[model samples]
Target: MSLENNKAFASVLTAGIILLASGFAATMLYHPQDLEENAFKIEVADSGAEVDAAAPAGPVIEPISALLASADIAAGEKGFKKCSACHSIESGGANKIGPALWGVVDRTRASVDGFSYSDVLNGMNSETWDYEALNEFLAKPKAYAPGTKMGFAGLKKVDQRADLIAYLRQQSDSPAALPE
Candidate 1:
């Protein structure tokens, strides 16, 4: 055979060998399981059917006062700086990007007049806002209300949320105390 033809054939054979070795090595090294075949299976017994799985245990939440004290007013105030861009806490202040937040604490959700609210907030048939509910909502907006249009991402730190709620409480007055 001509030298050129021999060299070309040798190169092609070498390439084929490399490809075959690579594919075999990969399959041997990583024997991936077929999820559709075996991963999803149902077991039946004479008594009944049973399924087994594992999930992480959820965390135990603490009280609002303890969380707030841990966060401190200063931290909450700092956190509020971001909110100041769209909201105002001064009593009777005009609504800006968002509504005036002067007396939001303990007030009914979406009860503010004139300002429009999402259906989710308006649909909530709740009496009044409380510390625990406020904390959950602040921690994660969408998670808490599902369809709220507040636009705020959410505060991760529980203490920070408590502090913010505390700050709101300070700005607003409690509902008129009922007389016996």
Candidate 2:
């Protein structure tokens, strides 16, 4: 082969060798490993098949009505920062990925104007955002309403959920009275 041809072939071979070596080096430096357990776990409900009547299902969720009376609204506001990404809590706020949450406490489900709601939430025209309803929904969104478009994994802490709900109540001009 000509000197020029041999030189080009050598350069191509060297580049390929360097690329292969870098790939191996990268794998060694940053290898993936299986997690020991999931960082966050979500509960999914059973299908339409009937469950054993006597057998108690999953963990029993405690009602948060009493907790709301003393819920730390400040802490709840802090916790709700994560939700602000998709929702706007200010009065007359525009909708984003999720609907505007102004006056959401005690508001009817899927009642926000100009926001496209998921079929799951839209189907609940008769439902209201009552304290107990919010508690159960925030505890486990998917379990509360299956096929919901909401992606939140649901807060595991009852206190945190209560606090958030309390803060939400304050956002409205006329907050609904706490449950009896």
Candidate 3:
């Protein structure tokens, strides 16, 4: 073919290729959801179906033996700062934002004098502040007794919770009377 004719032919071929490519690009852009829906998928088992055989029977509260043995009163005192915003640890202390925490370690949940608590805490009258109860309550205040006035997000760390309990115990009149 002549040079001009050959160039014209090549130009038409290039234009056609470009046009084809542009059409494909435009279609893909406009129909992205369709491309996503047509993607390869693999089926997996639902995570909720798996049973945790090792899960504890009751709420995972810290043990009394471990807390009494290794309980650090200093750390507990430091942890008590969080509670100090609402509670008073001094013996025979009056109630504050929440109830005074004096004698609370072995005392009942909401038995403090003249201080009104939410129905959740009041409902726990029979429950004593033993190690297990304290641990469970401190781990998740709302979970232990729903609708409690104490708005604390329970201390997740077992050791820290233990420390706070120990510090509170020390502040009580009968600190030695607390279960070992």
**All models, RMSD in angstroms:** 10.3, 3.5, 13.2
lDDT measured at residue 100 in model 2 versus the true structure, 0 to 100: 93
Arranged by lDDT, best first: 2, 3, 1
Q: Report, for every candidate in turn, its global Cα lDDT versus the true structure.
A: 0.72, 0.90, 0.79
Off by over 4 Å in 1: 1-63, 69-71, 174-180
All candidates in order of TM-score, best leading: 2, 3, 1
TM-score of each: 0.59, 0.78, 0.64
Residue range 14-71, candidate 3, lDDT tens digits: 9999999999999988964446464767533335466777975455565764766578
C-alpha-based local distance difference test score of model 2: 0.90
Q: What's the lDDT of the predicted structure labeled candidate 3?
A: 0.79
Candidate 1's C-alpha lDDT?
Answer: 0.72
lDDT of 2 by residue, 64-99 (tens): 999999999999999999899999999899999988
What is the RMSD, in Å, between candidate 2 and the native fold over all Cα? 3.5
- Per-residue lDDT over 133-178 for candidate 1, one digit per residue giving the tens place of the 0 to 100 score: 7777787676666666677878877777878887776676563221
